[model samples]
Target: MMHSLAVRVYYEDTDLAGIVYYANYLKFIERGRSEWLRDLGIDQAAMKENSGHVFAVRRIEADYLRPARFDDLLSVETALVQATAARIVLDQTVRRDDAALFAARVTLACLDGSGRPVRLPKGLAEALAAG
Candidate 1:
């Protein structure tokens, strides 16, 4: 039940040494998570507008295992590891071929328009549970 996205490393993704900047790995996984939700028919904007709820990152436990260089084609994979009423935990990885370059355990919290923690929408909870 892994959701994956393909990303090509560009010159802009690289640091002065020509390897991808460490922080950019977070960006790559963020895109992967967005696509994963989209694939599940969850629209963040719609959720915010209709349900008055939005998602925010609560924590991330990340590991930098290897370096990805410019021009590399990478795959970001995301899977739901756990889900609760107010939070979801995901395991994500950035890989080049068979090698893992980065990995993270991400916790996302659902929040109301006022930024107060709230329960996840039933649809989102069900989708993750089914997966």
Candidate 2:
């Protein structure tokens, strides 16, 4: 199943040409991922404090299909594509209604405080799978 979040383009999200800056698409999907985890009862800060684990974006493959302009209302659709002991992969898209404007495959790695790879919390894996 896919999870979604709504985003309204702010002027700051745009360039002088009125289209959203290329980098901001990453921001939009990042929010989608964070909210998805939040809704699944994951508190990132608490996870870090309790488990000494943090999630880092290890890789991203993105395609910008079209431009989103200032004031455009968009939805970011996200779904888990895969999960491993130390990594999670997500498929995400930014859309206007049914039109896809951007798409990405993001890989997140679980890391210890010392920045070494670590297993994701068990509860996190279960929750993400269920969600």
Candidate 3:
């Protein structure tokens, strides 16, 4: 399943040139992923408190395709590409209307409080698999 989130580019998200800062694209995609998980009924805070595990970015490959200006309404789309016991791969894209402004492949690892790799919690794994 693909999930989409709407974001409005703010002045603070841009550079002096009024174009979105390159790194803010990452933030937009992160929000997309967070909302995606939320929609799947995975609560990160409760997962952390009950299981002592959290999801952390393990890798990200991103491309800045075009410029987004302040106040532009953008849509960030996220989809799960693959999932494993302790890792998941997702594809995300940011678009201004129908034009793609950015794209990324992100990997996340499940980690214990000690920062050691751990299997995803049972419910999260089930949710991802079902989705």
Candidate 4:
């Protein structure tokens, strides 16, 4: 796995009926992937300062399977499904304990200042692999 992050749904994270808002799950998954990269010494700001590169979500196809509720402790699991010179595929899942609530397959790209594609930094691709 790339990395996993635990998140708790607060009242602010939920709808009036106590169900988590759909958009919040996307926020959780995004944080999971960011933390995964941080674990590998990849800081978006530092990457730009040092190498003039940054990573961006080029496309995403996500599914919301079940509704999460307030106070539910969920885990966001991230894994690298594939990689190329300029792009990567990340598989992410959100689970409440043992129950899966949502999932996504995100296609991301590395880009320079102009937003054009650029090759991933050396070792970045290797680090994205599951252990």
Pitting candidate 3 against candidate 4, the one with the higher TM-score is 3
Tens-digit lDDT track for model 4 on 11-125? 9999988899988888999999889888877787788998888888889898999999988889999988888999989899999988889999999899988988999987686
The 10-residue segment of model 3 with minimum total lDDT is 122-131
How well does model 1 score by local distance difference test?
0.96
TM-score computed on alpha carbons, candidate 2: 0.97
The regions of model 3 sitting more than 4 angstroms off are none
Q: List clash counts for every candidate, in order.
A: 0, 0, 0, 0
Q: lDDT by residue for model 1 over 49-128, one digit each (tens)?
A: 99899989999999999999999999999999999889989999999999999999999999999999999999998888
* Candidate 1 all-Cα RMSD: 0.6
What ranking of all candidate models by lDDT puts the best one first? 1, 3, 2, 4
Candidate 4 — worst ten consecutive residues by lDDT sum? 122-131
- The global C-alpha lDDT for each of the candidates, from Candidate 1 onward, is 0.96, 0.94, 0.95, 0.87
Give the Å shift of residue 46 in candidate 3.
Answer: 0.5
Query: TM-score for all predictions?
Result: 0.98, 0.97, 0.98, 0.92
Instruction: Report the lDDT of model 2 for residue 20.
Output: 97
Residue 81, model 1: lDDT of 91
Clashing pairs in 2: none
On lDDT, the leading prediction is: 1
